[model samples]
Target: MTSSLLFASEGFGLNLNVFETNIINLAVVIFGLYKFLPNFLGGMLERRRSAILSDLKDAEDRLDEASTALSQAKEELSSAEQKATKIRNDGKTRAEAIRLETEKRTVEEMARIKQGAASDLNAEASRVTAQLRREAARLAIEKALATLPAKLDERAQTNFLNQSIKNMSKD
Candidate 1:
């Protein structure tokens, strides 16, 4: 090619063939970028996409496990509550039975104590009546001895003695 075709005249300086130079520079830059950048950038983007997908799968698995655990915990809590309720009811029934038994025993004891007291009172009354009868008999014998006369004739003494014996026997 002629030098004039390769170099063009310009007001500022000698201008190289502008269209050809621009085309060659663009081609070289495009080839160099394509040669190195596809491996580096492509591999980085692929790794990033793979990591994101794995993270998504792991999150889904964790969510499913959490749901299962929650359901199991709820079932266990329900069972525990049922057991607690049963225990409370059993305790109430046992307490009621014990109360009834205690009341029955108390009533029986009270009746027994009252009967014993009545027996004691009856025995005391009989003892007092016997003592009073004995005291009255002793008083009658003393009165008879004090009132008898000592000076008398044989026939008079015999009659007086017979009357005194009769009075003593009557008492």
Candidate 2:
């Protein structure tokens, strides 16, 4: 390695210190990077990290808001379902009431019609009975007159009228 590293002296260089030269080059590069690169790159990295963190915070806040909104929507949906059930029950109740009322009305109307028909029938029967009675009384009076006239003189007529008066008084 020593022989490989040794070189023939050129015209102006007989002595060479490679280790010191390498160390000096390394120092210069290190100092140059330290002086300029840390300030610029570190500042850029910090700014980038801050922007990323801010975006993450905003996203987290948006996620929370969205979850809250979703919860509220679910609650509203549940309430709406309950309201729909109540409305359905109310409608059923109203329909039942209407049916009952209609049935009651139908029954009342039937009763009224039956009563009116019965009244009409009774009136018609009473009128027929009265007419038959009047006809029967007229026939009886004619038969009595036809049978009584063969023996009826004025004296007999007077005696018959007196007997009729006496029977009526006894009754």
Candidate 3:
């Protein structure tokens, strides 16, 4: 192994000189990168931060608009419910009024019919009474005519006839 190391050192000898290793070039490049990198990266980072802020502002505005719209919708629904309740109450009142009116009319009509029927019955009774009186008067007259000849002689009948004629002339 020592022999191999000696052969390697003779074939490719190590240089101790700094200029031959290019150390100054590496240091200059490192220094330039350190001085320039922050300016470029700072500008990019500032632009990204402003863009994120703008997006956050837009999101907040949209949320406010959505909240306002939801409140308005709730108010409209409440108003509609009130209107529906009012209409239902009015309908119930109207129906009750109609039913009461119908009942009143029915009672009035029944009273009128009953009165009419009673009036008709009274008129029939009065007519029948008058007819019975006429019939009784006719029967009495016929019976007197049939018995008149047996009760009166010819001379008496002649005298009664003369008396009836005199009474009619006086009236």
Candidate 4:
């Protein structure tokens, strides 16, 4: 009974052969995991890195495009502002020119009107003077005819007729 208890190989005894076999199996599994898992996990990690780098590059390109578009918009805005200023200046210039031309035309028209009025006044004065002279000559002729018959007697009329006939023959 004492020998059976001390040499219990099939129960709780420290069997070196089984222990060595377990150790060998664990070492083989650890070696297999170490050999194959790094390659598989490394391939997955490399693909993930490449995807991240591609996303970063695409973001940078988009940023550059946005910056270029913003610059172009700024330039176009400046150009439009300049054009508006030029248009405003041109409008002012044209308005000034038109105003000056209108003023000149107004002055010329006033001058022409004044000249026409003066000429009309002078013509009216000349017509009135001529009419007055003709009226005075007619009145003088009438007065002389009314007094000539009473002043000249038959002998004086004969002498006047004889003198008028002598003057006509000398011409």
Best by TM-score: 2
- Write model 3 residue lDDT over 27-137, tens digit each, in one string: 899888788877888889988989999999999999999999999999999999999999999999999999999999999999999999999999999999999999989
Off by more than 4 A, model 2? 1-34, 142-148, 158-171
What is the lDDT, from 0 to 100, of the residue 12 in candidate 2?
Answer: 40
**Residue pairs with backbone overlap in model 4:** none
Per-candidate TM equals 0.61, 0.64, 0.57, 0.62
Q: For residues 1-171, what per-residue lDDT tens digits would candidate 2 score against the true structure? A: 333334544434333465644768888899999999999999999999999999999999999999999999999999999999999999999999999999999999999999999999999999999999999999999998998888699999999999999999999
TM-score head-to-head 1 vs 2, winner: 2
Score candidate 4 by TM-score against the native. Answer: 0.62
Tell me model 2's lDDT, rounded to 2 decimals: 0.90
lDDT (Cα atoms) of all candidates against the true structure: 0.84, 0.90, 0.88, 0.91
Backbone clash pairs for candidate 1 read: none
- Candidate 4 residues lying further than 4 Å off, grouped into runs, are 1-51, 154-171
CA deviation > 4 Å runs, candidate 1: 1-21, 136-171
Question: Judged by lDDT against the true structure, how good is candidate 1?
Answer: 0.84
Of 2 and 3, the candidate ahead on lDDT is 2
